[model samples]
Target: MAAVVRGMFALEPAQHRAESCQPGGRGDASGGETQPVESGEIPRCLLVGPKGSGKTALLFQYGLSLVRQGRRVTFISHETLHTMPLHVAGATKPDPLSLKQLQILYLNTQEALLKFLSSIHTQAPLPTQAPLPTAILVDDLDYYVSTAQTAESAPVVARLCAYLVDAAYFISNKLSEDKTSVAGRILCPVVATVAPPGDRTALQWYERFLTSVWEVKGVAGQPTMYQLSDASSAERAPLVVTYEIGGTLRVLDVQDLNEPMEGDD
Candidate 1:
């Protein structure tokens, strides 16, 4: 949905807009050639950072935004979430009733997580009366990929990513198939996070599946302060959003003039 902005993935609004990744193309009437038309775009975002960079808080904020728009969210994690984020920086506080729309699921091991995704990919199971998720957030996807203790983890990890996009993203696309506007008046996005790996070489293997990459960087001169920026962009200086999560999540400042001014709320 055009209403989608930074809340989608804490990304630079201008770069990740729906118009940026429109799928398919249309005939160019003037040139009789196929040209890309503005259709619905699927935003596949990957959030990379180290432990305690507030990645979970950012993802929760994104899920809360979808809930407010009347969409359901499924947050999958390796362990049970101990706390729910409230009063996040640059985000609206979600009410009790609305928060119910955000469901949490825990799959504690890589094998278990992969199995769940594979099952859902084929069956697309849903709770008795609940609607399909408009957003699927995997907190620390690395837990389901990098921590595998075997040599065959690569293919399994790749499968996890596939089912995530196929099953999770398919939920949004199927809902938007007729509506044109994705379910919940927003693009059904798959937003996931991963702690930066010890060996940087492992990164390229994952980047192939991501459409956009946002990084959480600790502010050099400040403690308990961090910035989120799009590391996928190679063209221009990316927009940087500075935020804090000491007690309550609060945005202290932002940099980069190229970010869009409208639809930011």
Candidate 2:
């Protein structure tokens, strides 16, 4: 079965690529490691921003890249699922070329989302024979938490966050135990999108679980800027990226900003 799965999603022999950022700039490496290091160097990350800040789009870009590399990507979303490409819906049976490699799961309510994370945590090993690495993308986590904000259910959200952190550790530890696993692959990293908390107290709650946080800032119809800060260091300079519908995505670094503007003398 492992062989069959391998055949279905052939691993590229080329060196695994890491997320790139300009010198002194920080870019979120939620989908995979940022450097050519071990599989579990950085396992969990949170994307925080206001609405219309393009957080979902950033996550989609990461997931799409993983899928293109023939890796397994599981996307769990409370919203924006309908806007995703049709292929991300996945296939019933394995197809080498199909988006079966990308599994999309939708959870509308907070309870369902909690249950899903709990299941992953309790399960010793994921039910998959494939050697391909897996990455989990959680979109609109704020929406999930908001839905269960009643006084009685408030604790559930905190537990949910803890479970997510546990899940990432469980997956990372498993991959780390297997030294032969591909570097910069195999370990599961949890990347979630979160809106700025309405209550200041909630800030510490998230900081407790997430290893890194990338704050996204931008307005609709404008380039989005990402400022990343991890447990290791203070926040770094932002990286600007622009995406157009039906057009290519462009990234602007510090050097790019120094270039002449359209109307510059």
Q: What C-alpha lDDT, on a 0 to 100 scale, does residue 26 get in candidate 2?
A: 23
lDDT of 2 by residue, 1-265 (tens): 1111111122221113332221101234456553332333545567777765556656665565556655567788875466443221121223456466777788888788778766664554335644323677788877777676575434655677777766655565555444454443344667788887766567556656654565555535445433322221335323333323223223332222434778889
lDDT of 2: 0.52
Q: Which stretches of candidate 1 lie over 4 Å from their true place?
A: 1-5, 8-41, 121-129, 152-156, 177-187, 233-237, 259-265
- Using lDDT as the measure, which candidate wins? 1
lDDT of 1 at 5: 29
Q: Which pairs clash in model 2? A: none
- Count of clashing pairs, candidate 2: 0
Worst 10 residues of 1 by lDDT: 20-29
CA lDDT, every prediction? 0.63, 0.52
Clashing pairs in 1: 1-186, 89-249
